[model samples]
Target: MLLLICFYQDQTSLLSYTAAPSPHPSWPPAPGIKLCVFITRLTSRSFLTLSGHGYGVHCCCFSSCGSYLLSCSTDGSTMVWSSDTGEAAAVLQHPSRSALRVCAAAPDSSLLLAGACDGTVALWDFPSKTLRRCHPVSEASVVACCFSPCGQMFVTGCTYGDLKLWDVDMSLLYAQKDAHDLGVTCCSFAPLFQVDGCCVQLRLASCGQDNQLKIWIVSQREGTACTMKLLHTLTSQSAPILSCAFSSEGDLVVGGSVDKSVAIYDANLGTLLHILKQHDRYVTAVALSPTMPWIATGSMDRTVNVWRIGDGDSRTGRKLPGHSGLLLAYWSEVDVQTWLCEEGLEELVSIFKANNIGGAELSQLNKEAARELGIGLAESLGLRGRLLRKIKGLMAEQSGSEAPDEFLCPITRELMKDPVIAADGYSYERESIESWIRGKNKTSPMTNLPLQTSLLTPNRSLKMTITRWKSSQ
Candidate 1:
């Protein structure tokens, strides 16, 4: 059974242009960064801290019904805690493993999987407090893990740039290895997928160092070994991708990156829908709250931030705080995107409009406007000859055109400090600079009257010009 409940974001993003006189723009940053935070120290209270890991929680997930909260740590221990009291319910430890990156419980709440720093996956029965199995992985660190919705299979993200799939029984080769440019950072297997005309099957979703998240379908071709086909490739968030997860509905995907925030995307279409920003640092971890319409994040800042889920408007999402160390995160999926060429194109269009950026010709328009402004200023000033030459040189030195751009005197090659009139017989006096400069124009040797020149030129006939230079002699 799926819930159709929609969590309406009651609060509007303050960064939204709605309040600004700038009028409504478009989607994407439809509102700017709302100047809002999901978690604030003054308002948020600690849930509970499971000591002994020597660090704060990195990743956390709930069972099928929100009965138990499973958490992993950088200190190399995975703990099962009661969702009610935040008390440590069970502690699972591996002596050799030093850091635990991710721990996820199966959708049915029967099994728990942990990806550790030592390149190994640890499976725990939970009820027996016994290790059901432990498998050695390659050199790439296990950055993420999750159980498919059906729990028939599990996958691990290893640094070797591949997603390794294993059957729950651990008997045969479920999936040998898959492709990614850098080490695979995270993997999620869609527990429920339709295959071969109405037959439900399992598929996998993965995120890695390449800054893209991919969807794979397991297909057994005749005369060829069973393989996961690269169904779709997505791009939106900038990398190194920190985390990715699916909403319970599974039609949507959320991911974070070194870019400092998370993005919402059409899962079926690899287009970006919205960008949410709040965390102080890179969003290293994220989790989706299916029932509550919330998404949680842990970052390098040692905090867990819970945000409103869906595209309700980033400003109003309720934020909750958790943890004490640099928060890394793990994520899971709810429903996988259905592959339909038409639907994919529609999604692409929607996301395209959502993150709408103007075309490349915008650069040309800016350049033209700047050129016009310079021409207008030049025509108004009525400057010519050496004066124009000096002004152009000064503008060149400034490098850019701005309202109050710097003007470097062409001869000095230094910024114009105190400009003065250069008419009349050469005269020097210790006096107020502006008044003295003005006095020179009031009376000139040519005519004991004000100069007709518009301060654009000076009568240098009797001027003593002292150009400074180093003499080789």
Candidate 2:
């Protein structure tokens, strides 16, 4: 059976589905498997079902920005759907017409890869929806694939117990034959890369039918030659692992197994951190939210469970107070009015309410926007001045101060709203670094040396810490 699960950045909605065989004759029938995807909004308690795959969907993944959802199926096609509208965006057919077992989208959403049962992998350009190339990477069925954080390379695993690394051009970089005693099931790369002088280090986790989970260190020196070495081998679970994923900051790794348990591990020490046993059947899929302390797992019993990772008690889940836990971008109109009242700007609440100003609009309000909105003229000059200062104070509260130095972005020197780790092993504000690179600067902001890659991985752990600090204040 096929199962998939995904979560929104705000924890507002969840995407999950189970598959059952359909009677349609458009394609050959696969016994006892399902053929549909479902998107569920937790707030509204609504469901949107996507039904295009002719057979069981083996895997599904959301794009980097969570705008699009991609799924691969035994029907020999990879389908893309708009996350907002639930409409099919494109249908990518496998060149060999073989059943696709897994699919992954690149970190930058520039390319997509789908692996087939015949060991053929089809690479498609994301923007144009056109096939770029198809290469046979293994002699056995290609069951697992994932792109590296740098977006310059990817790894693929097959039923032959082999793991191979390749560049974006599809050229093999390294191969580990017999990486697992049995077939490989899933693999994931850590979101951050460590830069040591001219060498870059990446951590990868892979699990297989041998009932073992292994971690490897893949090193690339001067962006040229590469080496792979096993660092840790974990056999905490009693059954074969079916899925695995790394947390956003690479601090933890999670795996789901046929034993109906989800295991979380400390990525650095490779020690078992938690074993969650809520599923009644084999756990088939697992995903860790990049922006929140939430874990989602899909099981063969046709259920998906979400678990929260806590600081004091990892086993206990707690809720944050007021607007402390919610992202400012997702604040509602009522939330904004409440904030205004708390800030002693209750006099202007009517005006803000009339303009339908929410958290997002509040964030963009400035002197010009305020004047355009008639706030500058309608209110007394002194009141306007207080309002402006309060807004600035809000920005400062969200950015830096009393916050840990590590939580501040290196470039902006402010508390980061969207933090990302660069190649130099430092986290920075996403907009600042993106603008820096967009201006044709290739040197590392912290090291003053040449950057190995332009890719940036989300610093989810740091962001969560900042959020907690804000809540405590």
Candidate 3:
């Protein structure tokens, strides 16, 4: 058995167990035990259920130091609590007694930003424990707020899909055009990183009901006005992406969706890295642990799941050996699949035996569901090829239906529509392989050897074969 252990802020232990000698079907086995990729092994995971909020929690943020946690809820109150002791540190009240829809703490933890239903953004002075300033951001309800790393300014997203920049003194700086077609649900500032002695790169990430994550790059000088530019536009297959966050280092991004999955990405490369399908309801909020290798996600189901960041290449679809029992349990029950869409894992698991679903008879259905769900999750996260092969193995019984290895792109596990041969004499999709060569990487993804040239030779033969195969299907 492989034993995976996790330690949280309060030294709570979460344990999971899996049998070893298993390898993800697509990946070759490395010596020793492997990490279980799915959110199974529920016995080993733990989370703190903060209860002071009388209603649903809209947001949860950890301080820069990760010593405290600030949670804002629809209960018209925002509370600061000790992450270690789970003790309430301070409670900030909204003047309108409206639900605090969003909240953020400055990097220094000296100030707090809370957005309420009354269309006002309140600034709270930390040490003084007093209302510092109350600024009306819009006539519509303010739904999202984030503090820049330096804490000089912050940004707010409203129900009207407007994004407004505000100064620490409650002055309006700049407002972007309607960032999303629909309501903006969440926004986060990338941790400010010093670019040089004189300037810093300030980036912001926001997501909304319109199914888009916009990365805004801010160009700022020491004393001059800052200019903002749209860096990248990430569109999701899931119609409404509810929450998004940047890693403490600002190099990674995570977003939660209404489809009950969390997507992780390489922020700089704009590559989808992993799709976490653990949640059973709309993920309402996501927060990264500044000090620990974990990502916390809160959902409409009223449960928080903290995922451990395993030291593995998330892009690779490495997983344990497949088992038919788990496969059937996942696929056979139409009710379980429905519950996976409508309820939490506990509810899904509880109804397993009661449904009278079991055995190898349901393997085909499970395989089909796995394929559809995996593809949908991957596409929703803008990770087209990232997860196609990892879950592909779940269709163990349908071995003959698997695509020929030569038809697959080496960089992305998905089948190639336009195959190409690089100077290294290896085949890959035209786009995937070219992206690797054109981007920061100059070496071949398959061989890791330096490419003599970035030129790619089209493989018309492989394209014909893929076309013929598709026609046969």
- Model 2 per-residue lDDT tens digits across residues 76-194: 79999987777999999987667787999999999999988778899999989999999989988898999999999999999889999999999999999999887899999999999
lDDT of 3 at 340: 38
Ten residues in a row with the worst lDDT in model 1? Answer: 13-22
Indicate the TM-score of model 2: 0.60
TM-score-sorted candidate list, best first: 2, 1, 3
Prediction 3 TM-score vs. true: 0.55
Q: Rate the local accuracy (lDDT) of all candidates.
A: 0.50, 0.75, 0.63
lDDT string for model 3 (66-117, tens) is 5666777655688887655557888888876665678888989899889986
For all predicted structures, in order, the TM-scores are: 0.57, 0.60, 0.55
Ranking by lDDT: 2, 3, 1
Q: Over 4 Å off in model 2, which ranges?
A: 1-36, 43-45, 311-473
Clashing pairs in 1: 15-34, 16-31, 140-159, 149-191, 250-335, 285-329, 302-325
Once fitted onto the true fold, the runs of candidate 3 whose alpha carbons sit more than 4 angstroms away are: 1-51, 301-473
